[model samples]
Target: MILSRLSIINFKNIAQADLSFSPNINCFLGNNGMGKTNLLDAIYYLSFCKSYSHIADSQIIRHDEDFFMLQGYYDNNGNEEEVYCGMKKRQKKQFKRNKKEYGRLSDHIGFIPLVMVSPSDSDLILGGSDERRRFLDLVISQFDKNYLDTLIRYNKALAQRNALLKQEIKDAALYEIWEEQMSVTGEEIFKQRKSFLSTFIPVFQEFYTYISGGNESVGLSYRSHHEHGELFAQLAEVRERDRILGYTTRGSHKDELEMTLGEYPMKRIGSQGQNKTFLIALKLAQFDFLNRNGFTSPILLLDDIFDKLDSQRMERIISLVSEERFGQIFITDTNREYLDEIIRKTGHDFHLYQVIQGNIESLKEEK
Candidate 1:
């Protein structure tokens, strides 16, 4: 799917914008905080129905504005599609396809499969285990309906179990209720996660090698209590202990994706450059994983990620992203040097714009 045109109003710093795009590469140039990322976020909002920065919808509306709107015109396999989103102060955001509102946001997950690489991704390596689990869940949920549905059920069960623990409910039967749901759904979630990693890790390694020129090594190991015992049995065993802690302690909620650099923890051994490279490769591999699945050529967003890398890796990334398989890329950069290189390398249709204080104007275009 390709976003041929995007219309925005009162979203983030972008007061309003209606811009056409090159199906190949659409580049935005601006200094920090001039709304380049916000423009990309508008596109991201249409894709995921939420901000990538994880802020409240109320925060998204422009100051002094009571409502915000976003609409995207897409070309999918020669068919045209329209996606619209609107939010009013103190009201739920509405997302629609072809002018019809969605019954559930989950139904929109895979429709416009997208992968974004930004500086915030550093949290995947530096933040807690929950960050890594979120990475896993986001990728898998985009491609597998069963996995997404099972994850929703498992989280619901976990929340009920935790509430019971908080209340100090000692009835094993009461605990057994939610545990039954968690055991059935949790086991399915863990299996899907394990299966995803089994296929995902190798592709990630291949991307890391290509990006780093094979100068460094990386690994991702999945750790789950599911491997230790059946989820129900594990929950029963940990029940008494969890009662003391006041939260459910044994389930897929405790899962982790340990990232390693050359057999050592990435957080301990990775320098700033290596960390950025690792994350970029990880996300590109995610794009590859999604594109190969049912989603055809998922949109790719690169947001000011060229900093702190040597020329070799930068050129390698430029060469890699210019390949034919990747499609409909949106790139944001603080300067033109790297964007110029990418435009030169790809030799495809492109439109470049300058963003200033929520205003966007076309600087150049070629087709």
Candidate 2:
């Protein structure tokens, strides 16, 4: 899939702009706070129907502006596909495909599979387990609609069960209802997650090896309560403890995707470069996985990710993606030299743009 054109209006710091994109690589060059990342986020929003950093829709709109709009023209396997997103303060957000608005936003996912690697992704390593769980969900959801729906149902049931736990009555019968639902849905989620990781971990390790030059050994492991026994039995055993804790304690929500360097946890032992390398490898693995499963290469987004890496590592990454295995890519960086080097190395068609205080201008096109 290729994003051939992008049009933005009142989206974050970008006030008004309409730009075409190359099928191979598109680079945004600018300094910090100059809206380079914001431009990439706009493309992300078109794919996922939400901002990567911002939580509230209203916050994404340009300050002092009432609304924001984003549109993308894509070429999917020779067919023209257009995605449109519009939002207003104190109003509902609208998403459309080929000009027809979708009734549910979840339907838009997987239609345009994309992988984004940014400095913020370090949260997966340094942050809590919830961050890692989100990583798993985002990757799986793009390929498996059933897995996405099961996750939604599982969360709803877990919420209901937690709400019951907070009540004074503590009706066993009511608790059993949600518990049974949780067990069924949670079991499905656990199985899918387990199966996915079994396939994913090897790919992740491969990328890590290539990017890190095979000097450091890395590992990824999945941990879940399902391995002990049936989720129903486990939840039942934890019922009393959960009641006291006022939450559901035994479920897929607590699963962990542990990252390791050699035998120790990467978070504790790895340096800044190692951690960044780990994350970039994980994301590139995600791109490879999705491209293989989805039957088309997912658009790749690299958000200021070249920082803090040695020249050798950067060259390895560039060489990896410049191959025919990858598809259209969008990258952001503060240094023009790096972008120039990448453009020259790839020797592919590319478009370079300069971003300044929310305004964008096409710098040049390399053929």
TM-scores of all candidate predictions against the true structure: 0.99, 0.98
What tens-digit string does per-residue lDDT give for candidate 2 at 276-320?
Answer: 999999999899889889957899999988898998888898788
Cα deviation of 304 in candidate 2 (Å)?
A: 1.2
The top-ranked prediction according to TM-score is 1
Best candidate, lDDT: 1
Give candidate 1's error at residue 329 in angstroms.
0.3
Q: Candidate 1, residue 348: CA error in Å?
A: 0.4
lDDT tens readout by residue for model 1, 101-138? 99999899888989999889999999999889999999
Overall local distance difference test of candidate 1: 0.93
Question: What's the residue-level lDDT of 66 in candidate 1?
Answer: 98
How many clashing pairs does model 1 include?
Answer: 0
